[model samples]
Target: MAADDLPDEVPADPALSASADPAPSIELLAGPLEIVDRITIASNATFVGRIGETEVVYKPIMGEQPLWDFPDGDLGHREAAAYLVSEAFGWDIVPRTWLRDGPLGVGMVQLWQDVDPAQDAVDIKPVAAVPGEGWRLVFEGYDDRDRPVALVHEDSAELRRMAVFDVVVNNADRKGGHILEMPGGHRHGIDHGLTFHEDHKLRTVLWGWAGEPLLPDELARIEAVRQDLDAALGETLTAYITVTELVALADRCEHLLQSAAFPHPRGRTPATPYPLF
Candidate 1:
């Protein structure tokens, strides 16, 4: 795609949800027509253009000096770590995440999944009862014959578990827009910039499994993460994560082992400072 073919600004879509009060306008980053516009989808993050058809999510390098209070650009780093760990654990929920330069400078890019709501029906009431305000983007998906389908299902066991993963990682921001129900039975998780704090900040909609035992496979996978920490994977984490943050990551693993449970942090405020959709 030629740069000239791309729009100077991304077309605003009401179907999408964002935390930016005055939604940020999309802009071209330095690249081919690869990335189109900057989109603010959550309170603290934004999704930019595509890298060869894949969604490129650009979260700013926020710090005490910036309006957003994320520390040392650690949020994005933790998300990358989470994706690396999740992939190693054999979980297929998180989208492929990688570090890249974005409209706001350096950030992360993720894969986008096509969601057709009608074909994959989900229980919405439980999600509605999720005690927060979030925008549910209603889009139409079609069959080859042009049949219409809305692919938003809030109640699926697989989706619930992916939510669990977010909490375990101390994800402070999980909204309806962050959960993508893709075509052909796929639900992808995104916007993982807020997670892995020293404290328990598991705020998400997948609380259905709170206090439940981790499946044997899940526990085994956790053990594998513990073992892999000392290898090159640990080096990779060290590259981006501060020493304090790395220690916090280890503590979460220990907490999981001791409780034989997924423990929500005591008295930690909402992962997101405010409601986001």
Candidate 2:
């Protein structure tokens, strides 16, 4: 059925809804898949569905549109790889994601995250002047018809952690809308298909911490991921990206570790994404 025909929110399947397991088993996800709703605005065909008791965002490989920068038919695996890196750091920023065979062929399936609509921390707003304390200026520009406008984001610790994650993963498309604000002020980063690009492609909205010194705890987390790369992290990522890309990931960690500061975007392409939100 078309996306418009489906309900805005479909109730989870009866059998799947009963179980309260926080993470769904791989077996269930690879088994029968049922689409509950379609996310139409997504570049690729994306859906919300129940795999056993878990509601997941499924992005089938068949639906992925070819991109000039990324290899074709690899976005799903890239998404899963980003989750692996997030797990390696124990940051809990990226949600539970995996690659599996779905009704529309193999794809990335991630546990659906329910974001609190009340929180506007990640929301980009146009302001006449710099926002006070809690907010961080992202960039300043003029709106259409030549009116001055400034884009600013929240300056929360959770977002800082996410910015670190994006740096490590070389995320090429860290759009503002991709940051999910969960209950209790927790933050989750999603849509990581454009990551691990073997080159510096770290575009994002969380540049508020740029050039700031890395805290001891944050450095420790980076160190942990670097140590694990040769073993668990490396092994898991090989299934998703090229060996060269893996090497680039390690190099990025080292760069961050040595600098001990948030990176200032360099090179030609603009550091921030278009349509900032």
Candidate 3:
């Protein structure tokens, strides 16, 4: 729980700052579909589009539930934070998001990614009722001219390395369903609300590398982040997270740099955190 296990706070770059207009334009997949107003986001929120186009996941904003001690139905702030970090890290993961006014008033707009079509459909039956339930795995390939190969496999070495990345971020949710298998062997991660915790509550299903060693490049990245902790990037995270939480994030980076091997987290295995959608 010390303030030394997190990534440095990354600041927003002038070139990638949030848009000036708080409310952007809204559109529907079907022509002239009614834009339902003030809809609430509950468990029943359903996805209405494919990955390539706009996928609308509807949920009521009014609620008082708590997941991981964080307020429920606050997808807006979570979406914003995810966008900021995803952009800063230059990660190919996660969908691009923008704040906008929608049927539920002001909300977030995100790009939808499709499920991989190569691997056989994952049987979501096994982990359906776990604590943070409801997960499904995507396939590995799809036919097309522009698509590339999938980078990481669920049980591959690259994915094991990704598990380490998740640990450093204290990702509480990393269930099988959260990891996406794209058309080309590209693997992407989604839903990053529980990261940057004040306490080092690192939990994730990508624990395939729990006791492994970091690659030279990975270690280098960790060290570089340590130097940037108190700089621009760290400063940006402070805007969304508390100062203490920011410190905790930096602490994680430092700890990772000091250790030759990955450290085990204290708790039961962590599942993938749920996305607002």
Error of 1 at 28 (Å): 18
Candidate 1 residue-wise lDDT, 54-74, digit = tens: 455566544212224454545
Candidate 3 stretches greater than 4 Å from native: 1-64, 72-75, 120-153, 268-277
Worst 10 residues of 2 by lDDT: 6-15
Over the stretch 39-114, how does candidate 3's per-residue lDDT look in tens digits? 2433323233222234543332332245555554554445445555544444445556543333434333454567
Give the total clashing residue pairs for model 1: 12
Clashing pairs in 2: none
State, as a TM-score between 0 and 1, how close model 3 is to the true structure.
0.63
Q: What is the C-alpha lDDT of each candidate?
A: 0.55, 0.80, 0.49
* Best of the candidates, lDDT: 2
Better of 1 and 2 by lDDT: 2
RMSD of 3: 11.5
How much is 100 displaced in model 2, in angstroms?
0.8
